[model samples]
Target: MSSVPITKHGAGLLKEELQRLKTKERPAVINAIAEARAHGDLSENADYDAAKERQGFIEGRIADLEGKLGAALIIDPTTLDADGRVVFAATVDLEDLESGEKVTYQIVGTDEADIKHAKVSVTSPIARAIIGKAAGDVVEVQAPSGGREYEILEVRYV
Candidate 1:
């Protein structure tokens, strides 16, 4: 499998979730299953069935997170020296050519992409168009609403 690019913060969050799942959720589900089993008849035990289902979900999530962590290529934005060009993990400040609206976005991994936080995936249209561009360059993005133009105002490594 190809390496999955992830920001340092995203990798830390994944690791923390993996730890919580293994140490807390896994053990709690096991205990719940055991207690439900001790309640007697297994045929009409709704609690046992529910606990088992929850255990399945938790185990599945743990496996998924582990796989992602194993394949992750954590990159610290601060360590990169791309000069003024936009790159993965770079925070870019942009101004809309039409509306004059200014916004900032950090190009991150797909798993960490959150528009509410101004973090965009590296594979996103805007990111793809802006990558390798320097400040003062104008980029055209293929948005769902049609083509949009943005001027790169600044590039930040943090």
Candidate 2:
């Protein structure tokens, strides 16, 4: 499989979730399943059905997380030496030319993108447009509504 890029912080979060699922959630669901099985009458056991469904979901998630971790290329933004160009895991400040609004975004992998936190997926239009662009560069992004322009203000590794 190809290596998937994930920020160091994002990798940490994934590891935490994997640990919780294995240590806490997995065991809890196993116990619940056992308790439901003890009730007997599998055909009519609602608890057994629910517990099984949850177990399936938990197992699937565990597999997914494991795969991601295995193929992950964890990048620490602070250690990036990409000069002033915007790249994955780089935090960038930009000014909207039309609206005159200033905003900041950290370019991250798809799984780690959180709009509320101003972290954008590298595949996002704005991020793609600005990638490899240095400060003071003007980029035009094709948005769903229309094309929009932004001026790159600053790029930081940290």
Candidate 3:
């Protein structure tokens, strides 16, 4: 399997989730299933069914996190030396050409993309348009709303 690129922070978050699922969620679900089984007929027990379903979801999530972490190529944004160009994990400031609004975004892996937190996936249109470009460069993004133009104002590793 190919290695997936992930920011160091993103990898850490995934690791924490994996640990929680294994140590807390998995054991809790197991106990719930056992307690439900003790209550009586597994064929008609709603508690048993719900516990089993929850167990499946937890196990699936654990496997998915493990696979992703095993193949992750974690990159620390602070250690990057991309000559001021926007790259994975680089936080960038931009000015909207039409609206004249300024915004900041950190380009990150798909799993870490949270617009509410100002993080964008590397594959996103805005990130794609800005990657490899430096400050003062204008790039047009094909957004769902319409094509939007943005001028790169600054790029920071942190």
Clashes of each: 0, 0, 0
TM-score computed on alpha carbons, candidate 1: 0.97
Candidate 3 pairs with clashing backbones: none
Where does candidate 3 stray beyond 4 Å? Answer: none
Model 3 per-residue lDDT at 144: 97
Per-residue CA lDDT of model 2 for 4-123, tens digit only, reads 999999999999999999999999999999999999999999999999999999999999999999999999999999989999999999999999999999999999999999999999
Q: After superposition, how far is residue 82 of candidate 1 from its true place, in Å?
A: 0.4
Poorest lDDT segment (10 consecutive residues) of candidate 3: 37-46
- Provide the global lDDT of candidate 2 against the true structure: 0.97
Better of 1 and 2 by TM-score: 2
Candidate numbers sorted by TM-score from highest down: 2, 3, 1
Error of 2 at 71 (Å): 0.8
How far is 19's C-alpha from truth in model 2 (Å)?
A: 0.3
Q: Whole-model lDDT for model 3 versus the true structure? A: 0.96
TM-score for all models, in order of appearance: 0.97, 0.99, 0.98
Each candidate: RMSD = 0.8, 0.5, 0.6
lDDT of 1 by residue, 1-158 (tens): 88999999999999999999999999999999999999999889999999999999999999999999999999999999998899899999999999999999999999999999999999999999999999999999998889999999999999
Q: List the residue pairs that clash in candidate 2.
A: none
